[model samples]
Target chain A: MTSSFLWTLRSFKHFVNGSSICQAGPVEKRGRGRRPAAQVRGEILDAAGKLLLDEGMGAFTIERVAAEAGASKTTIYKWWASKGALALDGYFHAVESTLAFPDTGDIERDLLTQIRAFARLLTRTRAGRVIAELIGQAQTDEDLAAALLEHYSGPRRQLAVAAMERARERGELAAGVDFEVVVDQLWGACYHRLLLPNLPITEKFATSLVRNVLRGIRA
Target chain B: MTSSFLWTLRSFKHFVNGSSICQAGPVEKRGRGRRPAAQVRGEILDAAGKLLLDEGMGAFTIERVAAEAGASKTTIYKWWASKGALALDGYFHAVESTLAFPDTGDIERDLLTQIRAFARLLTRTRAGRVIAELIGQAQTDEDLAAALLEHYSGPRRQLAVAAMERARERGELAAGVDFEVVVDQLWGACYHRLLLPNLPITEKFATSLVRNVLRGIRA
Candidate 1:
């Protein structure tokens, strides 16, 4: 077998091993061999994400994703039940690994660190805009909206709340303070910045927000 | 001339006297009577807002809105420069008259009152979903986004901040507290709740949010 064929065979084996479907390989030679399923899946997701970012969410369609990814429609449908699900998966996966909460044990430091990191990621990435658009689309498209809330918003809010709870346990929060509301306040700033687009979410803003929340909540 | 025509004549005289566009009157009985410009304008705006709420931002078009409103396309073009402009005007005018800052004079009570009122409005109106969708579209559509921020977010933020400042001036807020951050935190909670559909913005949630922020910020 040719080198490209051998490479495709190896990648396919890795995919079957349940590795992430995004591992890149040497470009396949024409007529050399079939592309690996994993490679094809990654291409589709990449194309979908690009289309979402470049053309807005309205441009994301199964046919377009298939054409751009050089994959068959059947291939994509086999993985995702619907186009919105695929779009959500593609959008979520792209940013999933980056969702981190700080645990510096200093409530002020931790909150500021987390907020700034999130702000930077959101403002800097094409994925950020795509996610925002998807959330907006969810308002009208019930299925997409439900999937987003379940897969995206629920987890993120839980994470933030958990962080606040940890701070409360550490006595960083004042007695009788509501952890849920504190989390909302932190998250609300981020959402307002994203949705409003008036103020730049600068480091200063993030730092001040963390400090203010801590000062207000600290026992 | 029919009574409708006479009525149109009287309405046009009234509009001229009031220095407003002569746009309202009964439709010409035989399709040859003068239609008041202001009536046509209001009809167009009403149609545009309805379309935006029902069909998402993409369905907004001069021709479509004119047809839906029973006005001519020429009439629409004469009023607004573009579809985005028309949509913007429709959205702003729909919500503008209802806008107000809570002035209960107590910071916590006022903030909570304002949030509760807004939450009720958002949940009650079809326009709420349309506004959310427009904000999303604005992220990609530069002009729409700019208009939204300038006309909507800017004023809203200003109102919130002003309320906080008033609280500080009245000694309801802790000395040296970062007022801007406090505003961001509160505003962020409401915006996040709107965008993220997982957490229902129930009255309890709104009340709890206010209570927590007040607890955190109170001297």
Candidate 2:
């Protein structure tokens, strides 16, 4: 009976020890030194984006971002020259990761795919909210506006223009059709619908838009 | 010589008095007691919108708005239950003044007219910035979101729908076309372009959009 009781106590101690180990594992690992550079950069951007989304542009201070990212403020300032630069980098990264241009070889299909993807991204993410804040801040901050235009608008537009050019090259475009104008129309309609909130963006609307734009430009 | 000096001094006195009058006129009038309700209401909304555009939603406090409007805090709170209520009123006023729908007899022409008007207003005014801000803020603030839909999106959509219906009644619309869907496409493109900078909301693009939409929807 004494031997059995001792054995039971030993088993209970082992169980308790095992449970404690499991519970303490994550906590003990919490302070593991600096993450890899790429990971640290990504984490910093994510925190900055969350700050921008939650508290507006004014809350996107370098110190706040660094604290949220679990990195030193000196580390962030070393990588980015200013808060605006950091914010711009974060904005650009968020947009690139989420909104990709479609190049399905058929202009109509490609455009439809692109528009729908963009509409979904804009409607469903904190990125959309961040964009609106950036736009508002842009009115007063010329440098930030220029950065947005360069990093966000410029690359996306070049992709769109290239896609339209490909359509023209493939003999899919009508004679005298302005490719730039067509691209603008497609992009404009998509942006307006997403931003205005006057109506929900439905798949049917996307189909009609693609059909209409293709009709306007098809050879 | 005495007469000339006296006249010069009198002129200087008059200039000083006029400057004081110009500076003090609004303050003196405000101090005289209650302003007309309609006038005060308009002033309050204008003040709120200015603050919203300049400083985003964060700066839109009762104290700030009341001070800017030159009205008592009690008067402002009497009309608006909260800052959000005041913001809603301000948003509607700003949007309505700048983005009224066209009613030209030709549906294509009218739609083009409205799109161009919206493009120009959004590009040029603080109204556009404010609208974008409100939309972003609405994503987080459910009350503001509902209020915006009820007051702004609902009315504007009704106007667009009415315009489409008028076209249908006039037999200008194709029998199988969905009017609501077409309007959404047209306006969506326009809104999308406005948010993206440096992309020309050009006359050429506008014409192509109308022509394309008409192609898809015309009887």
Point to the candidate with the largest TM-score: 1
Model 2 ranges off by over 4 Å: A1-104, A123-141, A176-181, A216-219, B1-105, B120-142, B200-205, B216-219
TM-score of each: 0.62, 0.56
Return the lDDT, model 2, position A135. Answer: 52
Across all models, the iRMS values in order are 3.8, 5.3
- lDDT score for candidate 2 against the true structure: 0.60
| Candidate 2 chain B, run of 10 with poorest lDDT | B19-28
lDDT tens digits, residue span B100-138, model 2: 777777887788888777776666555565565555445
Q: What are the per-residue Cα lDDT tens digits for candidate 2 across A94-142?
A: 6666567776678777888887776665666555555655554454445
